[model samples]
Every structure is written in structure tokens, then in C-alpha cells.
Target: MASSDEEKLSQQKEILNLQSQEVDEEYSKLSAILPWDKFSNWINCMCVITFDLELGQAMELIYPGHIKLTEREKSNICYLSFPDSNSGCMGDTQFSFRIRQCPGRVKPMCASHINYNHNCPVALQIDPGHYFGYVYFRQVRDHTLRRGYFQKSVVIISRLPFHNLFMHMVGVIAPEYFDNGEPSIEVACHDIDQWPTPEAGATLNLPLMGTVLQVRVPSHSDKPGLSQNLVVTTESAFSSPTIMPSVNDSDVFKCLFPILPHIQLIWELVLTGEPVVVMANSPTVCSETVLALVSMILPLRFCSDYRQFFTIHDSEFKEYTSRAQAPPPVILGVTNPFFAKTLQHWPHIVRIGDHVPATSNVKPHKLKKGGSLKTLDSKPGVYTRYKPFLNKDKAVLKRLVQGIQTNRPSEVQSAMLRRHFLEVTQSFMIPLERYVASLMPLLRNISPYKGTPRTRPFDPDEFLKSLDFSGPQLTTGIKGDWIGLYRRFFRCANFEGWYNTRIREVNRKLQLLHLEAMSDADLQSWVSGREEVEVVDLILKIKEKLTTASSNHLPVSKDVGEKLYKQMDAVIYTLPEDLRAVLGSN
Candidate 1:
């Protein structure tokens, strides 16, 4: 009996070891897509802010107190964590926003080598980086207090765009902090510190205090319906609330529902990187709506700056409000009414309100004129008169209205809306992607003797010339002024960013092709007609090229450099004895 028991224990231990090995191997494969070494932790800092009757909003306690913050940063953080009293924070509210990092502050370093144009999502495009603050606030009426109310918020600061995961963590941590105080925040922070680095397109099983939150970060290459699967699965005996689906899921549909008729127009505005402002009475709505607007042109990222939630106290208030210059291509979400007068000069303004009752007389399909810029009305509509190049898809409007009439689940309706937008965006991008590919020079034109070839500059007139023969009109079966739409897109930041990225990719390909061809060419033939000094000069030039190819500044493959090295070795052996000795000494 003892021998049998020992054998069973040994088998169990071996199984556990095999499982651990498998997990490690899987992680290694996923992490290869991006450099994970630069990222240190999942959550940078976790803190609790409370409303003190005398001091107003103040940081009550922050775990891992070693994080340095300037007084100005601390003040702004405290105020942002807590919502305005008029925002109607009855039981609980959740939101997120971006904050600019002060100069010389220590922050997570992102790998500059990753080609953001292809792999990374715009959410993780931190070239001009900032800190994302995820907050969970709660308020309740309390006669015992001087203000007759009690309010507090728990905040998480992260450099990553783990929106769904971090929001889930804060939801769990905040309630526990309110109940037990500092210990809860400390335990939650420790758990977050142990999490694996966030790799794009990777699903992670993050263990919080007692439950596991399963989440996936959207990859740049994800197909249309893949994002719907970004759901949570709980593993612990203790029950945890289900985390809302990721940003790509139906949550965006909820934000776009009120403006469903004008969605395509709004999408164009975002794709062109036009200035946009989303206004709502609640900060949560304003922030979510802004984020949703940005995602409309996804797969193709909106490269211009955007603020999920903007306050009058924000540092860029003056620059954004000034009339001294043209409005920068930016999107701002505001709950305060002050922006109405200040931003009146802006072109597009989307005003969102609480859900309109199904019985209300307002027509969901028609465009409505907005109220005077002075009032905070809840009516939802696009407050712009700018005409769209493409005609409205009346079929989409019919389906959405039918869903609302039949009381279909919002998630299903949202999925339908997302599918429509995805198809539209993909169709629009296909021609451009194809055109960019045509701009690359033929492989035969690449030569090491000459300077590296570049992709031809993008000309709107040249691209438009190809549209009549083949364009989105034929592919999508949707017709309108395709020429006009492309013309507007040419002026936007999105097009510029996309064009520049494609140019870089094409240039890199040209460099690699040159290297490969030079490696295979017979050096003897070229040197036979040249002076000895010229031959020496050529050898030194090849060495310099090899050095540059190996450096991080140039994105050349290692195997290519090795091939050139082997070719040089063979050439050196064939050189005259005197030349061979001179080359060997160097």
C-alpha cells in the first residue's frame, strides 16, 4: 500500500511539471511578436482618493508610495478621480482618461523597434506617450457629513492599454478598499505586479485577489468578428462580477446608437482626422463616446491626439481654445458647458444624451438641428452640417430601428453595427493598400552601387487616376462621390501617417534586396577592371555597410548580414597575396 501511494504522488508531481513547462513555452511564443523586456509591470500604481469636506478631493492613500508626483500632477489626479457632483454618481461609476506625463518623469519604456504601423494597436501606440487613468468612483448621501454626502474613488495608473482588464481589477479592488481600507489596495497592487506583460493579440488569465479575469488585447490584424469573443471567464470559488466586453465589442454600439443615422458621416470625420468634440452631461458618457468615435476608423488608427475626458484645468486648454491658429486635428470629450462657447468655432460636435424612450416622438433616422450653444441639452445627434461624400445606408438604419422595436439585445444590435462599419472601412482601405504596394520599385532596380531607392511620393492626383478603373465603388457595391471622399482623406493626419509608414516599409524592403543582390554578385569581375586602390576602397565600403546592417538603427535581418560576411570571406581568399595580407591586417 505504501509503495502504491508513493508511485501515485510521483505521477502527480510529473504531470504538474509538464503543465508548467507548457505554460512557459506558450508565453515565449506569444512574447516573440513584441519586445516585452521594456515593460516592467501591468499596473504602475494604485491609489484611493476621497472627498475631504475641508480639503475637497485629496489622495487618502496610495499603495507603493515611492512613485514621485509633482504637486500639480497630484492635484489634477485627485480632481479627475472624483467626478463632478452634478454627474449624478449615485452608487458607482466608471471612466477612463489620458494625462500627459511631465518632463523628466520616470515611466515605462516601449520598444522603439516594433513596427507600430503593422502590429501594435493605436491604443498602445505610445510614441508620444501618456499615462491612462482608470477610475471607479462611488457616492452616497450621508447627513452626518458637513456636505451631506460621502464620495470616494479608486484609481489605477498604467502605461499599457489594458482597458478591459484594468477596469475589471478596479471594480473588484474599489469595493474592498471601501470596506477594509489600505490592506485591500496593497494586496491588489501586489497581485497586479505579478501579472505577465501585455502582448497584443494574447489572451491572459490574470489572477486578482481570489478570482481570475480572462481578457484579450485586440490585435491590429484581428478580423471583424474576432473582437466579439473578448469576454471574461471566472475560475475561483468566490463569485466575481462579469467584466464588460472589451472596447471593440458592443460597448461602442451603445455609444453610437443615438447617432446611428449619422455614423458613416462621423466615421469619415474621424478617418480624415477632423476636429471633433463629444458633449454629454455625464463624464462617463463623454469619455466612452470619444473612445468609440476614435475606434470607428480602426485597423487604420487615428494618429491625431485625443482626450477621453477633458477638463478646463487641463494644461492644453489654452492651446486648444486659442483662435490664433487653425484648429489642430484633435478629438476632445467634455462634460462641462464652458466648452460650448469656447469650442463653437470647431466644425463637428456630437451631443449625446440618456436613452430616448421607445415611445418618444423623436425620429431616430432624421438629422436634427442642435440647440443654442449655451444650453446642456440631452438630445443626441451630430451637430454638424458638413455634407458626406457617400449616401447614407438606409438598410442599416432600417435594421437598427427594427431591433429597437423588437427589443433585441443591445449586444446583438451592437455586433450588427460593428460589422457594417468594419465592412465599410475595409472596402475604403483596400484600394489605398493596393496603390501603396504598386509604388514599390521592381526588384531589378535595386543596386548596392547606387543609393537606396525610395518609394514614389504619394500624389492625390495620381491615386485618383486609378480610381475610375478599380476602386471601392466596384468592391463594396456602394456608390457615391468616391473622388471627393479620397480628396478629403488626403488632407487628414490618418492618411499622412499611413502613407509614411508604407514608405518606410517599402524602403526597408529595397535595402534588404540591395544587400541580398550585392552578397551574390561576383566581386572579381568588378575589381578586374579597377585600380588596386579602388578595390581597397570598395572593400572598406562593404565593411561599413555590414556594420550599419547589424546596428539597431537599421532594420536588417541577421541572416542577410551573415550571407554578406561569407561572400566577403570567399572574395578575400581570391585576392593577390599582397592585397590579401593588407586586408587580413585590418
Candidate 2:
């Protein structure tokens, strides 16, 4: 009876302890979610810029003017906000870009600075010293206005890639500000200020002027099978918020439909980070086409520089157009006709326009052999005749064409394109991922007494040799000259960035493993075999390793080093009192 009672008491205590821990964890999570900082605003700054007849471009109002900005940054912002005169008589236009932040400026913790790489296998590699700007420009004919034009732009600058969210907010705010003026802008800024910290893959309910918008920021590390469908709802019982599509969900079909036949070649060029130019009739077309081209290699972030809307006034205009050297590896989207003559030296030029049907007299075969074609009237197509390695997916083209004929929803068409690109990108990346994995050293090879084993250097020729046995063709079951494709890809900037990042990651893992092995070692046995001087040298070395690991911000190494320190301290205590005193004196 005594034993049974004792056992019951112990079991009850364990149950209570577990329940207490559960409560503590739940409270911690709640605490993290609540207590929003008053100073943290979703938007870092907002600017209302107008075209000045006398000054060229001027800032009419920079809200919360305390935000420090250099002259160069202000100049770039003002110029980028307004479209050039070439985009003649535009009603309203929206575009997004990234610009380098002012040097040495302290970046605040806001939606833009939130690290999106939490729990990601690979970090979202981007220039951390830049801010992304979403601009909404409006041009109207007004007799009362100076220069007979009312031209202005509302610009939102932030660190977040909330393209769709910012666009939606600006769409409402710009129109209201245009009609009612500064008060409306104040209200919009306040609404954005009240938003919760934009957590990756979390649905947020944002309150805006008697309505609530439900939105989700797409995460870079989103799992393959997870639901990425963005649900946007409003407070009204009869209405819903406009569904904002992400960059990934943007309509590639509309952008690429005119040049569908040459899409494979275009994809290859982009993958290799080739200098390509996209010329379109409108700014909207020009920017969207550039984004669409970049998106075709989904899941693989394009690390090279690209401008969605490149203008003659842009700082890089001269560097990009200089004829003294080969064009830098960049993709530029331009609307001005002047680019046609300036960028003629570029390797690939994609001219986009509305599809024009061929007249009965114009035969496709006859035009193919014409060496002397002299007009822009030549059918819209990719100017370069670059051969594509991978076989083009006929099914994707057929489906997109069928969708157009049947008048399918734009969302549906976008989804189809996203799916196709996701598959294509994954198929291309799988072999590379596998090959890199093979280069890592086995666990048994790691030792506490020796230096960390380095990952084997990547050899292009050796990798190509392994393709026949295990490559994209076998992994994806897709027919292609993948070996040839990779041969070219090796020469590109994207491959270089990917390889460097992967190498760093592998080295980090090796260091972590070495530290863990040292922590698990028998320090007493190690010291027993060494002389006094050798033991002191070992102590100094361990101290140096710990300092280096901590300074480098390597969490795993630091944690293991702590354990190793305790083991070393125990061994030191086991030494003679005279020796311990001598060690302590040093």
C-alpha cells in the first residue's frame, strides 16, 4: 500500500510538471506576438514627388522628414518615381525597383528588414544594403497646371519585397491623395504603421480605412507541397479585397505569348546571365516582361543585376551603354526608341508588341531566308538565333494558347505558368544539389585531434562525366542535352554565386562537426599523454578556437566550445595544486 501510494504521487507530479511547461511555452509565443513597437512602421518612408518646370524633378513632400537621405538617394528616387516623357500621356502607372541605401545609414527593424531566411536551407542571397521602392505615377492634362500638365508620383520605399501588398496600398492611397490631399496620406501611413511585423508565411490582417486586408508574404523557403494560394478578404460583407498576385504568380503567358517559339532560347540566355534587352511599346509591358523573364527559372533566384525599368537618366545608363567594352551581364527593360540604336550591339533583343496576324501573301518560309529585311514591320520575335539545348515543352505552349482561345481566367493561366516553371527549375537543380551532396566528407572522417576536413573542390569535367549515370535526364525523365546546357551554365554568373554559397555552407558544417567532436573528447586522456608545455599549448589553442568561433557568430561552434571548456576545466582541476596555481597565474 505504501509503495503504490508513492508511485501514484510521483506520476501525478510528472503530469503537473509537463502541464506547467506547456503553459510556459504558450505564454512565450503570445509574448513574442504581442507588444508591437510603436516606432516600427511597415513603410520606412513615403515621398510625394512632382515634376518641377524650373527644377526638372523635385520632392514636394517627404513625409516624416527626419528620415536621413543623401542627395544622391533623393535624386535617384525623384527621377525613378516619374516616367520619362517617352511614356507619353500616361494616366496612371505602377513599377517597382531596388536602390542602394545611403552609406552608413542605420537600418531600422521593420517589414523590409525582417530576415525571410528563417529555417531555410539556403539564405535568401541579396544585397542587404538596398531598399526596394514601389512607385505609382499619375499624369493628367490640366489647364490650370504649370506647363499644362499635372504630373506627380507617390513612392513607398521599404526593405520588404511586398510588391503586391505595396501596390494594393498605393492604388487606394494615390487616388485618395490626388483628390483629398495630405490628410488621406497621413491616414494611409497610420494604417501601415499599425501592421504586425511581417512574419514569413504568416497571414496578416491589415486594417485600412474601415476595411481589413488579409495578405500573406510569400516565403523563399516555402515547402514544395505547401499551399501558396494567397487569400485576400475585406471587412465588408458584400465585397472582397482585390487579390494581389506575387511576382511568382505574375502572368508570364501574356508577356511571352508573342515570342512563344523562342522562349527556350530566352530561358537559356537568362540562366547563363547573358546581357538581354526587352523593348516594348509601354512601360507596363517593358517592366512586366523583364520580371516574367527572370521568373521563368523559378526556385533559382537570379543573383545577377537586372533593372525592370531602365531609363536613360538612371545612374547605370552610361556603364550599360558604353561601346568601349562588351555589355555587362545584365537584363535591361527599356521603353524609349533611342535604345534601339544604342543597344544594337547587345547580343539578344526581344521586341514585344501586340500579335499581328500574317497576311495571306506573306509566307513564313520565304521570310526565313531573306538576308535583307529592313523594317520594324518584321514579325515580332527574338532577334538572336541562339540554339536551345533542352527540348521545348510543346504541352505548355498548347495549354497557354488553349487558355487564351477559351478566355480562361488570368489567375488560372498564371498558375499553369508557375507550375511549369517550378518543375523546369527543380528538374535543372536536382542534379546539381545531388552532386554537391556527394562532395561532403563522411562522419567517420572527422576527428577531434585534426583539422576539419574540407569539402572536395567542384570539377566541371568530372560532374559532366557523372551525368550519364545520374543527371537531369534520369531525375526529371525530361529529354534534353543537359550536359551541354550545364557546360554553358558553368561559364555564367549564376553558377558562380551558387557554387560559392554552397561551398561556404559546407565549410560551416565541417567546422560545426569538428567542434562537436572536440566537445565529446576525453580531455583527461588527451592531457595524460602530453608534457606540461604541450598541455598549456593545447589550452591556448582551444581558447583561440572558442574566441574565433564566437566572434564569427557561429552558434553551433560556440555551443560546442562551451562544452569543451567545461571538459578542459575538469582536466585542469585534476592537475597538481602547484601546476594549477601556475596555470592560473598565466
Candidate 3:
């Protein structure tokens, strides 16, 4: 009877103890552990140009203003120049080289802009991400009408070709500059020329890189004209921000990497729904894919359109051949001062113009008995090409989705799957857009000990009480520190990334359960228990710590996680002979 009475009392006291825990959790709301989330990636883009005669020498130079290369990247540069097809540039020579181990910008050209595209026959293109600002060209001269203007095609670059272009220069219009809807910048033509320069285009003396320059409408002379309304403060001076893969301004790709202006321009178009002139012979579909990325998707992730950038290099490419041998020229349209040829990967290297190498007339030896030549095999028939759905054909949203299922284009003309892809890129940007929002301390309602979706149950207050922690939430503070960096990387990943997907699953599970009804007390207990993993949250925690730790010094926990990993690796590398034999004893 005495023992039974004691057992009853113990049960009642345990219940009462739990009740006390609930009360403490209610009143003693200590800050939760911080979420650590940090991530990073490189934003890459490219550009291409076709003009009369390809760049003369093997080395080339291009300037896409917003992107600058870092000193470290100066070494990966390679420039490959190839010979023009059977035809020769009218008085112009065609020469080319393959990119090898050269660094810096490599601008190729000779001493003329003629009808070289028709003459220089063969061309080889390298993928954009391989090296920055890898340019290809076909020069066209028009003395019949515009005297000597060249037409060039600009292309945005990708790790592979067909990716959208990125912009190196951005036209910034600050709030003070926008009194009305117009920008403070006033553009005018110095030697007024029309688009395409079709008829008697004004022959203007352009800057070194070779494109025509436009005069400003609000021409406050550099020499301070009378009636100056312009307020040129030291801060507001026209200090052009360089755009490119320069070390100082690099993100994921190294600094000094050369992504061209045209490539950068294309990426901007995709991210912001801007329209690029889709060339008839475009390698990949641009407009449709861009719409899927920037407008519909960017908004989903909180990404916004920023500045507009361009490269003076592409503009100068118009007459690259004429100026190739006339001293390596600077990119035209770049507002900055002259840059050195040393900035190019090669040191003043020029493709010695192609001339007939002296050949001696000699008799050829007969073929060996076993090596009789055979006639060429019958020419293989061309395979049926996968056609893409035109954006015009997919003007509506519903049609766009259906088109993704039907018109499947790949390798160069592949925006046929835009409807499906757009959603992901949109999701990828959320991490960046939500950087500040996710860290607000007041909004977190999920209890850590309760582990609603993933953790096992534990008495929230009791577990915390036994921890012997005199410190502020070590994990939580660390999380707070990295929230911004993590969010940025998360959003950039389009939510399809591994971490983003796991988090979505957790949120979904929470929504399914009536988790709101559970008190903070219940949630806290759950978090403390082992039921939930909260993998994304855990990863963020690690990321937060990793930020301060050297990459080599990431922390290793000694909990079951550490043990499980060790057990796994142990199986791979068998135990010592004695230890393996001793397993039976256990």
C-alpha cells in the first residue's frame, strides 16, 4: 500500500513538472538560435562581334564598362586567330589563332575593313565562360553609301554559347537626375547619323576603339560654358563605373575575367524582359528564355532590374581590321583614357599576315602497297533539326506553357521550354530578395525544442534549463550574422537547388498539420527532440559559422551526425585485422 501511494505521487509530480515547463516556456521567451545561411556564385556573361576581316593579330582587347578583370585572372587569357575562308579581304588580310595559355584581353585585327566575311572562310568559336570577352568577327565595308562603316553582331556569352548576354556598362539615372521622367543625361549626335547608317552616313572621326561618338544635348562644355546649370560636385562627377570581370568588382568569376558588353547586354535582357534584336542566324533563342527568367520569375524571387551597361570594345570592332596593324587601338565609345596592349593576354603579338610560304616544287613518293587511297565515303545526309516555337507564336501565357511541351528546341535554339524554366529562375532570386526579411526576430514562430516537423519531443524549459549555457544563443547569433549572405545565394539558386527544396518541404509539412494550435511550449519541446532534421536550417547554421571560419576549418560536431559519418567511412576502409575479428565478441 505504501509503495502504490508513492508511485501515484510520482506520476502526479511528473505531470506537475511538465505543467511548470509549459509556464516557463510561455513567460521566459529567450531569443531562439539564429539561422545561419551564407552562399555565393559568380555572375557570368559574354559578347561576340562580326566585322570586315577578323581581328588582325591573335591578341584582342574589348571594354564592357561595368565588368573589370582582376589581376589574378590576367593569366587564363587565350587568343586563337584563324585564317579567313578562301576569299581575301580587299587589301585586308585574314589571320586567326586558337586560344591557349594567354591572359588579359586579346583584340585581333589587321590594317583594313573590307568585304572580309566573303573572303576569310572558316571560323571557330569558343564557349563564353571558358574565357571572358571571347570575340569573333566578320567585317563589312560600305563605301557605296556610308563611306566606311562596319556592321557587327553583338552576342551575350554563357559558359556555353547561346546563353543570354550580360551588360558591362550601366546607364544610371539617379533621383536627382530625374526631375521629370527624362534622365539628366542628354544625348545628341556630334555628326548626326541615322540608324544602320544606310545612306551617306555622316563620316565622323570616332575615338580609338572605332565606333561613332554622339554629342550631348545638355552640352555643358568640359571647359565650363556660360550659364552652367549643371551641378558637378566631386561626388557627382562622371566617374564612370567599370563593368566587367575585374578583380575589384568580381563576384563568383575571378576578377579581370573578360566577359564582353554584348554578352552582358543579353543577360540584362533576360533578367529584365528587355528585347534584344534577335538575329536571323542567332545560335540560341534569346527573347523567350529571357522573359521566363527576368519578368515573370525575377519578381517571384524579389530580384529587380538594375543598370544598363555596354562595351566600347564591341563598338570599336566595327573597323578592327583597319586598325589592327596601325598600333593596337583602344576600344571606341569607352569614355575612359587609353589602355595598354599589355592588358591583352599577349605582349604586342600580331599574326604575321598570311602570305604564300615559299614552296619548292618536288616530286611526291608513291603510296605504300598497303596504303592505297580510297575514294571519300558517300556524304552523310543532314539530320532533321529540332525547330523552336517562335515567341510570336507563343504570345499568350497558356500557349507558352503548351509550347514548352511541344516545340522542344535544343542546342542553340532552345527557348522552347521557357514556361517550365521561368518558374525556377524566379524562385532562385528569392534568397537575395528576402535577405533582410527572413532575419527579423519577431516573425519566427516555430519552436526549436518542439521540432514540429522534424525534431523529437522534449520538455522545452527543462531541456534548456539543463543545458548549463551562460551564453546568448551561440547558434542563433551566428545565424543572424550570415542571414544576408545566405539569403542572397539562396535566391540566386532559383529555389530548385538542394537546400531550397528541402526548406520548402518543411514549410509544406507544417502547413499540413494544425501546427498553429500547438503552443510555443509544444513547438519548443518538439525542436529539442530528435524527430526533425530541418536540413536547410542546419545547413544555414553551418554556413553562418563557416563565414568566420577559414574554408578549411569548417566545424565538425561530435553528436550522432559525426558518429554516423564516421561509421559510414569506417565501412569503406575496413578496420584493422584484430578489430574486425573482435566484432563477434560485441
Which candidate number has the best lDDT? Answer: 1
User: Which prediction has the highest TM-score against the true structure?
Assistant: 1
Q: How many clashes in each candidate? A: 0, 2, 114
- Measured with C-alpha atoms, the lDDT of residue 123 in candidate 2 is 26
lDDT of 1 at 141: 91
TM-score of 2: 0.82
Two-way lDDT contest, 1 vs 2, winner: 1
Give the TM-score comparing model 1 with the true structure, all chains together: 0.84
- lDDT at 544, model 2: 69
Q: Would you list the clashing residue pairs of candidate 2?
A: 112-159, 112-160
> Comparing 2 and 3 by lDDT, which wins?
2
If both were scored by TM-score, which would come out higher, candidate 1 or candidate 3? 1
Query: Model 3: per-residue lDDT, tens digit, 345-456?
Result: 2111111111221112311111112211122221111111111111211233234334334542221112322322333333333333233223222325554323334423
What lDDT does candidate 1 reach at residue 357?
A: 43
Whole-model lDDT per candidate:
0.74, 0.72, 0.25
RMSD of each: 10.7, 12.8, 29.3
Write one digit per residue (lDDT tens) for candidate 2, span 527-564: 88678777776676666667677665566645676798
Candidate closer to the true structure by TM-score (higher is better), 1 or 2: 1
Candidate 3 lDDT (Cα, 0 to 1) = 0.25
Give per-model TM-scores: 0.84, 0.82, 0.21
- Sorted on lDDT, best first, the list reads 1, 2, 3
